[model samples]
Target: MKTESLSQLLSFLDASPTPFHAVDALRNRLNAFGFEELLEQESWKIHPGSKYFVVRGDTSIAAWIQGTESPSVTGFRLIGAHTDSPNLRIKPQPDLNQHGYLQFGVEVYGGALLSSWADRDLSLGWNDLPEKQNRKNRRTLFFIILNRF
Candidate 1:
């Protein structure tokens, strides 16, 4: 059971290249487990035994389980986590050429072990949504992986 859980975690990390992607991944799992999405701008109808989530700017998310017991007597349970991997990020106008060799301008986003990344299969992920759906849809994620430096 531990091995299965660890494998799932590694898979999740591999799939989530960015914080936004990570949250979306979590949202997908929550949905599979019967959780529903809640919009912050709208009125809420929370009930016991129901699960719901709300995302802020596609970068952060909050999820909860509404228990049957009143919070005044039985307090709520809260679990929190943050996702941030020390990795490279593509800069705006990412294309570059050095000595006639094409390259992508990448900036390190966190405290990454730069030496560990040598010869690894690397990829870039992106999400493109229409302006109108920026407040709703999340099916526009895409990735572009470069095989060579």
Candidate 2:
């Protein structure tokens, strides 16, 4: 792998802290490559030699490029990938005051290595929904590191 490619990958990882953020980053990249976003509720008119993408529930995404040849003549090729990984998720009521220390209640979302996470720097990222129905949801990323004496 080239240094430039590695740098880009690191940048992508840094930008994507949650599944929603990863899908958004992917959508932006696809848009830059001439891919049109298709909504699940809307009708789609797919044509040959065109690029199209669809996002589901703001977490999953699918993008494809149509070939000039028919499906019967040239078989389709599909690739599968996931943006989710082992991580901790904050609960709805995460604030906990224990022994004069303010802590957050978190749950493991996947097969996270809890032992490995001890004394390591971590960040919290989430989609903040607005109170107004017309307003768009905002993405917020916060970083915090706890050190033990």
Candidate 3:
């Protein structure tokens, strides 16, 4: 059982490239475990002994179980974790011609070792969300892993 759980965890980590992917993965797992999704924009009609989750910006997720105990007497249990991975975002005008080679302007967004990225294939993930919808319900997603040079 432990080995199977470890393998599943490994697979989850392997599949999660961006924060959005990670949140989506968690949502799937929670759904499999009988958790329902809740939208922040809508009014919540929470009931006891029910499990629900909410996502924000496709990067943050919060899940809860409505136990029988009242909030004034018994508090809730919170298990928090974060996924921090290096990301590079392309600038508005990313097209560039450097030394007769096409290049894109990029800015790193996390604690990443630029030196370590040298000579390594880089995978990039991006999502475009509509103005009305939060990042949780992204309209389009692009998962791209650059070929090794």
Candidate 4:
């Protein structure tokens, strides 16, 4: 992992108010590494050493790093803890009228000290692609399951 790129991740997350925006940040970073963008509605043919990504809707994100083996079962070790810090989010119908100040409606995810976020800047990333209930809706937006570190 590149330390410079990894360090910038926090700031990038801070800039992305939503997960979709976060993926956009990641996409740019991955482009530097020569990864190709996969079409959302296109078919995928998996092989060795081919990196690709997909977005589901608006909330989730995911990606994969290719391995040399044809089956690509190269396992080394999973280092580093996956961390998701708590922060604020804009309400679906959010406005600045509440408290006469601009703020976000944040819900704590996993296990975090919610009180601390009141003073800290937050960074967010996305993962997972779950099936949406409505099939009739055309996918103007895509959800991504975070796959790249």
Candidate 5:
């Protein structure tokens, strides 16, 4: 890959710490490429030679560009990929005070290496759901430095 493309990929990775954030980043990129968003709850008016994308549960996304030819004549091309990876996630009740230091309790979501995570900068990202029905959920990202004393 080119240096510029690698830099952009690194920036995207930094912006996406969780599945929700990754989908959000992908949606933005697709929008920049002229892909229109499609909601599952609504009906779609698909057009040939147009780009579109759909998101589900704030974590999953699918994007496609429609071909001008019919599927029976040209066939379809598909690609599949996932955004999640092994990482540490904060527990619901994460606050802890030990030895005059504040800390958070975390859970291993996948095959995360607990030892490798020690004494390094970490990022926590999550979707903040609103209590009110009319309010919209927000995406939150936080960074912290962990030190072994």
Candidate 6:
């Protein structure tokens, strides 16, 4: 695919609410640059000079910029990043009010600012599940107000 700056990627990622969304968006953009999506359920074999991508459920994804070399060729370029971010996530439940206020049980992950978790837009994506449509899915979007009060 046409190489884009990380800033471009970050903007794209920021626009996606879920990993499913991000991968879909990326696959589209990459299509303009000769990137082909690969299905995980099918047996895999790649000839040299083929650039391919694979998606896992709604979350994880991986892509490789293949040159005229085999896996055993010992040289390749790989750009790696995660499609998911942190938010108070768990299975659905009943009764969110523990006190007189709406409350959420949260567990923080990565370099997130705890104070900013509230009152801001957040994109979603993560490492779980596997689906064909998810290979072409992107859901939600976030607009964060980094500072409040």
TM-score of 4: 0.49
What tens-digit string does per-residue lDDT give for candidate 1 at 1-149? 99999999999987798887898898899899999999888999988988899988787889888888899999877888886678888888988889999988888888999898887877778777668847455657887787985
Which one wins by lDDT: 5 or 6?
Answer: 5
TM-scores across all candidates? 0.80, 0.83, 0.82, 0.49, 0.80, 0.59
Q: How well does candidate 4 match the true structure, expressed as C-alpha RMSD?
A: 9.0
What is the clash tally of candidate 4?
Answer: 16
Which scores higher on lDDT, 3 or 5? Answer: 3
Model 3 misplaced stretches (Cα beyond 4 Å): 97-100, 130-137
Candidate 2 C-alpha lDDT tens digits along 19-136: 9889888988899989999989899999989999998877899999999999899999999999999999889989999999999898889999899977776676777555688444
**Shift in Å, residue 51, candidate 5:** 0.7
Q: For model 6, how does the per-residue alpha-carbon lDDT over 45-75 read when each residue is reduced to its tens digit? A: 8867787888776467778776785556776
Q: Candidate 3 clash total?
A: 0
Task: Please report the TM-score between candidate 3 and the true structure.
Answer: 0.82
Off by over 4 Å in 5: 93-103, 135-149
Q: In TM-score terms, which candidate is top?
A: 2
Global lDDT scores for all candidate models: 0.84, 0.84, 0.84, 0.56, 0.83, 0.64
Question: What RMSD does model 1 have?
Answer: 2.6
lDDT minimum window of 10 residues, candidate 2: 138-147
Q: After aligning candidate 6 to the native by TM-score, how far in Å is the CA of 94 from where it should be?
A: 5.3
For 75-142, candidate 5 gives per-residue lDDT tens digits of 99999998898987779889999999989898878887779777676555667755678445555544
User: Residue 66, candidate 3: how far off, in angstroms?
Assistant: 1.4
Query: lDDT, candidate 3, residue 86?
Result: 76
lDDT of 6: 0.64
